[model samples]
Target: MSKRHISLKDLANELKVSISTVSRALKNHPDISPELTLKIQKLAADWNYTPNPLAMGLLRQQTKMIGVIVPDIVTHFYASIISGIEEVAKQHGYYIVIASSNESLQKEIESVENLLKSRVEGFIVCLSQETNKYDHFEKLNSNEIPLVFFDRICESLDVPSVVVDGVEATKKITRHFYENGCKRIAYISGPEHLNISKNRKVGYLEGLKECGLKFDPQFLVTCNLSTKDATRATRQLLTNKILPDAIFGLNDTIAFAAMKEIKNQGLKIPDDIALVGFTDEFHSTVVEPSLTSVTHPTFKMGQEAANLFFKCIRNGKGFSEKIELKADLIIRESTLK
Candidate 1:
């Protein structure tokens, strides 16, 4: 038979005292006699005793857990980010509970509730594409829960955040294409409501603005940018009264999709439409006319976010702190003149 736990009753019985007295003694209550305290300590040390963390948590009001959330688990970027978050979590002796929002507000809310039900100490979140309503998160904010937004944060939320200047990164690449003698440029942006996507659009406008080119909404296309979606968008772009001399994809995935479809449409890359994208992906090198893109330090972002999370836990109140990491431009064959 398994050995039974050494309970408060057992300790009290051994020391000829009540369970309440033994409890107070274990808690370092000053009223307990020093002689009795020493005796209880010695017995506890000898018995290989373990205090129940759950019971301790009941007194302190915490479960000592942290939660991290992202939009997609399959994306290499988020996976790298999560790896960084986990690395920092390990250093602080905190366990992380991760969930995927899958770009849906409903799923995001469900995940939040699930983590809260499990008594997570705090939240590190990436907003979902469908989340125009911030009420759910606002409720947590009002209750004074520690919430940090990473990557996809709502500017209005006023919460601690870690992010990059997506607008500036996109502007740099877009200007590079414009300077290379590309007259008509096409933009393939992500889902419309996403903050990252909006930032990229601002960059696109700024790029055009600096080039003294008129901003035509027709030049921009909003789509999921899958290969099939790119094929259709490519056809639509080509069927226009004017064809683009270059294309700016929000990320490498969109760039790859457009690259293949544009080539199939009988246009030589660079010679026809030079391509530039955001987020330097691994596949950029493997693809023909290797994509030039805005480089994001996903790993560092995650590591830093996790590091800050520990500070929040330690501080308890988790004062609002925002950390912005730098992004670099990776020039490659796709955007070379």
Candidate 2:
């Protein structure tokens, strides 16, 4: 007869260590010394051992895994969010399976399907740029699986969501610029399909109206958050007869590009024109004068999404609970005026 597959417990006994210790060593838990972990890992490999992903999935009907899909993994905001989710998952004795949408609806759908096929317990995602259709989300909902939308969420899906108050956050930042002796403030926002972008655009106009500043269509520029688009948008602003006194961006990446171009054009930050950005994130503080942006609670948002997912997973009828987190404005060198 064929010998039975060796288990972690069997390895632990052979190594004269407790099962818990072996498990921790295998996972490379911080408490385990690196030398000991290396020894344990060698033993497991010598045994031709394999981590039973399918058996684990069967145990939880869940793969003991959660899927996290984001618009782009390169952004600091999303990276922070994933870190938080990983922490929360670890606390719950679960692991994360992350994927990047790269702003493609097809990719998002394919990723979701793959995770589902693997029996991931739940999903947390930020929709892609081309995800205007609600059918994919509807399909997720219909599967009797848990789906939590975070950050760039859909407006149509009545599912649980985590996002900052875009309209109010933009209003606060734009109003601050208006009060600081800056009129003709330009708005550099993201793709128009994004709900957050639309909300912030509306708030920018509202801020101008609130400060008795007339809204100018010429001051509004939408870009794809790329270097080329950002450069072209900045050039468009320079070509205009009416120069903006300040500019507010939808996110830090676009803001950084625009800031670079503005400086190259002999413009000074908070001097020639003040600037504000959303997502007070990485490189914001490292930049020359630093960037003043709406500090989004990405980590907390991720935790909330995980918590909501667990609730749904445990409670059959409570999956529809919606959550909205508010954005905070972080004062820095860029908007000190």
Candidate 3:
């Protein structure tokens, strides 16, 4: 017989013992006799018997595996978050399966479906830029699977989430520009569909009001959160009849692109146009005139999201939890006059 055909049932049949007895013997359970245990262990080793975690999970109705989906894994922000998730998961004796969506909604849906078929106990996800609908996620809720969203989340869902207060964070950054003597602040925002973008815009408006600055429709430009798009937006803003004294990018990548464009136009940092970005990525410090940015606790967000998932698992149902983490502004040469 092929080794591939070897199984617990095969061992039980050969030894003329019940399947449960064979299983218990293999595990060295106290109820199994020492002789039987030794015999089963030897036979299993001889047969090269391998346990199947999926089958075992099905039998117990609990898989010690988790599924994590992020927009992109190459970015340090997401990588840091995944590291935190893995750290906490190891302590809880759970394994994580990671997938990157590359900001594609189709890929994100496919990954979720594949992980579901693999029988992961729970999920931690950050919505893809193109994912405006929540149907795929709703299916998980209907199946009673525990889920937690972080960073980019679907506000329509009642699921637990771990995220920073985007509005407050942006408000602080905007206020910083005003304090630094910026007369008109321009904001390069992301796609309107994203909740983070909307919240940040609100904060930006509030900050302008707080600073007694008028809202200029021309100052707010939307992009697809790409470097090329941000560069173009910056060019458009700089060409405006009324020049902005400061500019804020929705995220670090966009900010970096904008900074490059500003320099390309022979503009001086802080002196001509103060700049700030969200998500204090690694490049924020390395770039010339080091980028001023909002520092997100990405690792802590991941840890908290995983903790919330386990909490939902223990509760045996989907319960609502909203965990708001802190994001602080880091001043640098880019925004300092």
Candidate 4:
């Protein structure tokens, strides 16, 4: 081989600076001092370094790449949404760079910064469960970056977003439980800080009131949306003096954990304890006493987010919109009794 190709990363490593800094120096951005810019330029010339053709194209016109960030990438929930986003993006002559926060706030921030360095034209994000502070997102807005949020979003930010009607979905679940003669219904919720938890709780309370049932504090419990924490929450309700006749969880993971715990305690689903869950995950049908759940329009939600992101790019800063999609309850054996 004559010589190995030198990429921006390699140049950054040699210069002991960030990739973004090196990139700015190469572009002769005003932010980079003249002395440092000259040094970087001379180094690149001596090394015969050339930028990626695609990156050069992006500098000439647009990156044609959209950054997508989600709490987790392995879930069916996210996979479908990403498919939809890609479908819409490809139709518009754009591609996507996906990043997983893995449900960590710090990782979410890192993903944003890294994507920015890549110079993606826009971003579509779903908030991680641990994202209580929204400064990272706010920074994106302050810089006039085209940003859109889906599913779990930060309401404090004025960015465009797409979400399922969690309040209405939970209300439907509560109504189903009440219609099935479940008086003392319980809800296992996620963290209080999450928008999903707050909206669902509101619906649960409103549904109880609509059905002429008292909102019993004992029947409500919060978990961190982990299997272990969900199991603990379920156990807490089960051991109560007056056990709830029906139970629903924030998502299928929580519902699955609750189902296992309920079985371990010798409770019959829908007979002694009706069960329902959100997200309508794949295993919802395969599980014994097949779970009833809310099926979100996930693909549509993603398409809408991507569509909204393009709109934001065209509209520039101070443009905001919120799209709330509907979800339907899938009746199954778990709540039929």
Provide the clash count, candidate 2: 1
- Report clash pairs, candidate 4: none
Model 3 segments more than 4 A misplaced: 1-60
Model 2 accuracy (lDDT, Cα): 0.81
Candidate with better lDDT, 2 vs 3: 3
lDDT, model 4? 0.90
Model 1 lowest lDDT segment of ten: 50-59
Q: Residues 48-151, candidate 2, lDDT per residue (tens digit)?
A: 55454323334256567998899888888999899888888888888999989888889998887677666687788888877888665665565446778888
Candidate 1's C-alpha runs over 4 A off are: 1-62, 225-231, 314-318
lDDT per residue for candidate 4 within 45-131, as digits (tens), equals: 776565653243343458799999998988788999999999999999999999999989999988987887887877899999999
Model 1: how far residue 197 lies from native, Å: 1.7
lDDT, residue 44, model 4: 86
lDDT of each: 0.78, 0.81, 0.88, 0.90
User: Candidate 3 on 1-337: residue-level lDDT in tens?
Assistant: 4624356898999899999999888778999989889999898877656454223345247668899999998889999999888889998999999999999999999898788677787789999989998877875665567889999999999999998999999999989998999979999999998989999999999999988999999999999888899999999999999999999999999999999999999999989999999999999999999999999998899899989888888776559789999899999999889
Q: Could you give the candidate ranking by TM-score, starting with the highest?
A: 4, 3, 2, 1
- Alpha carbon lDDT at 67, candidate 4: 94
The order of the candidates by lDDT, greatest first, is: 4, 3, 2, 1
Q: Which of the numbered candidates is closest to the native, going by highest lDDT? A: 4
The local lDDT score (0 to 100) that residue 193 gets in candidate 4 is 92
